[model samples]
Target: MGYGELIIRSYDPQYDRTRVEDFERKCEVGPAKRVFLFTDTLGDPICRIRNSPIYKMLVAELGNQLVGVIQGSIKLVTVHKPPNDLAKVGYILGLRVSSLYRRRGIGSSLVIKLEEWFIANDVDYAYMATEKDNKASVKLFVDRLSYVKFQTPTILVNPVSHRMSRISSNVELAKLKVEEAEAIYRKFMSSTEFFPIDIGNILRNKLSLGTWAAYPRGESWSGVPSSWAMLSVWNSGELFKLRLGNAPLSCLMYTKSSRLIEKLVPCVKLPCIPDFFRPFGFYFIYGVYREGPLSGKLVRTLCRFVHNMASKSKDCKVIVTEVGGSDTSRLHIPHWKSLSCPEDLWCIKALKNEKKNSLHELTKTPPTRALFVDPREV
Candidate 1:
């Protein structure tokens, strides 16, 4: 079926809000599995990248009908060097095409146009993420777009429960001031690939709940902890809501049964799961870092603390985070295997050449497992 001429143009919220939201509804994203995922942008299509320093939203229109949408954001990030050793990188996200427009080149056209914008802005590199099993995305970005395979991070999700986990009596957890958190991150995480240079802005943003640190009860330091771990929480729920689709019947039955039992007997927790079948919100754990002995244990304690805090919010259903595939810290975080994605694929491309003999040529080297996932990108 031939659709009329396709025109790619910048998205204007004033006139495109409803059509964009409608287009988004038809583009529930995920691999074709018994369990997939959907996102509701909560009225604004660009909510995800709204707070970014440089961002753009483009829409593909066929005969005045919006058929595709793509969002991109540019930021200065560390490429594993000194604090001043930063590169301008563009992130492509929320790429979507209408079901009726599939295979008609709308998706690819939108991406090409966005890349042109990135090039015009002097972006050094461009990257994007998708599910590891998404063959279509792989074909589009890798096979067609010539983007190279980059980092593979695992997304960990632990649902908040009525039951709160008790932290070890020997551990002490405290909230850090925004300045303290920024100092710690710059001192330690500057070497992490893609660590944001404007991390202080992220921590001080309204959406950030705060940063937390955990350590042995008796041990402490003036500016940093000797044996400790720290993480920051971003209220991702504020940007969008998620709903699980085509979930397995066994899982659904368990969820319903557990909730029913809990209603019948309030005292019996029954491990009742939240109703993910409907739209729900979640907290994203970012800026995850640790050091010293038993730091893995400290990471686990920090996750439990976040889970307990999330439980207090009626809308927060899960605590989620992403870490490098080889990071041992994953072993310490509490998350359900079924609810977590073990391999989230990231693809990268160099739009401009790096300095001669520069070790900062990000596309040429494999990522160190110590990755700093930008919460804004999530």
Candidate 2:
């Protein structure tokens, strides 16, 4: 069927659940892995985004065949620039078109339809992310449409080690009541990109374990933090896992060798896991912010604390988080010797007149600066 024949509609549980999931499964893949073998709620479209009012799921159908799917949400985002602007924007994600139906404008059509959804909701700015090397996606977002590659971000992952290190004695990390966390976020992180206006609700969500903040070991203050920083831990272990059955033949041949390479480059902390391995249990820390000259220490302490918490758990084995490379705050997160984890590219476009002055040329590689997009938003 032609692109014109494709029907784009909001996801319907009764009629579209299975087909929509199949399309998503067909699209989900690791950089090296051929397929994702296990089925779990992690990344499950229906379970994750289906119920939220802001979240919308759409699928493209042609003659009873599901060809593509996309999901997005409308949110009020904070811009770091002067005026520390607040914008009603659209965050688009999980855009996928079946391989057989691609190159015929199906993906583009899905995007256009979603753009309509954004405009109708009074959102003029839209943004999304993809791996740095996803050339086809780059072309689709930048060339076909007028999107700019704004930031490059790394996904930092630390495995739960058997023997965990202690968080610095200077840092008295305490779990904050949701109310306290919300207040701190407003004071310190409000200018952060994609900082949610309803931060309290986000912290209290089922998937969220809790939010913690760091204060000097001895301090008595209320309202806004003097040099406060906070981060929220997300329970992703319950979300999903990578199944062993999905391992490619190359994975089998390289597992032992890859392990050796990883050990040799331990300082780099490179991700060389065999595609066949299962990612059973993990925690991801997000909504991190800190102030002061030693704020980076607070960031590192938070990461270590979260990783240690996972290490203490019987089922958990990994800890992960993403930060915009342009974000100087990420320097506070641990990385060394220029060998870092995979850095993802974030691109954005303006549906109306909002971002014309702000958007830059994709070909222009500017110096990295501060960029912050809440991981939950993506």
Which ten contiguous residues of candidate 1 have the minimum total lDDT? 354-363
What lDDT score goes with residue 153 in model 2?
A: 75
Q: Which residue pairs in model 1 clash with each other?
A: none
Candidate achieving the largest lDDT:
1
Model 1, TM vs. native: 0.95
lDDT of 2: 0.68
Residue-level lDDT of model 2, residues 159-236, one tens digit each, is 565456678888778888988777766766675555667666677788788988776667643643456566888876
Q: Among these predicted structures, which one has the highest TM-score? A: 1
lDDT of 1 at 55: 100
Query: How many Å off is the CA of 222 in candidate 2?
Result: 5.6
**What local lDDT does model 1 show for residue 145?**
90
Roughly what TM-score does model 2 have, to 2 decimal places?
Answer: 0.80
